[model samples]
Target: MYPKMLEVAKSEGNKEAERSFHHANEVEKIHAQLYQKLLDNPGASRETYAYYVCPVCGYTSEKEPPDSCPVCGTKGKMFKKMD
Candidate 1:
């Protein structure tokens, strides 16, 4: 629905709504990929893997977080780790 919302926002000339919907759509795509990876590796061990999440934008990473969030430009140091 974000894509559809994006289209609606575009048609209405709502710049802020368009930006929000576009960002949400892109982030959701990344989340879907991460969830698919988890499904594909059901037997994977947590001892060797972890998730790092950006506090600002909810960007999640299977490894170390990047120096900047791909979604919202949050700093890597602001990311919290989980296992």
Candidate 2:
């Protein structure tokens, strides 16, 4: 998406848009770094149970889920399954 935006900016001769697109790409790289850090050192663990807690919103789901939280976009590693 950033590359596409940059291409559009180039075609439209919009220097500001091009610069903003590059800035967004830089921000994404920083976010990726943060994610990598979390992956490297996931803090703790919880005993698996039937109920699952969403790390982002604290919403509990009765079913096992994938990486993304249904309510708040938290990854599966963030969930704490309750007994």
Off by over 4 Å in 2: 44-83
Q: Among these predicted structures, which one has the highest lDDT?
A: 1
TM-score of each: 0.84, 0.50
Weakest 10 consecutive residues, lDDT, candidate 1? 42-51
lDDT of 1 by residue, 4-69 (tens): 778888999999988877777778889999878768888764447778998876888877988989
Task: After superposing candidate 1 on the true structure, give the runs of residues whose Cα lies further than 4 Å from its correct spot.
Answer: 45-48
Q: On a 0 to 1 TM-score scale, where does candidate 2 land against the true structure?
A: 0.50
The per-prediction CA RMSD against the true structure, in angstroms, equals 1.8, 10.5
Q: Per-residue error at 73 for model 1, in Å?
A: 1.6
User: Candidate 2 vs. truth: CA RMSD?
Assistant: 10.5
lDDT per residue for candidate 2 within 1-83, as digits (tens), equals 78987999999999988876775675466556645755776772232337576655555555575567654467977888877
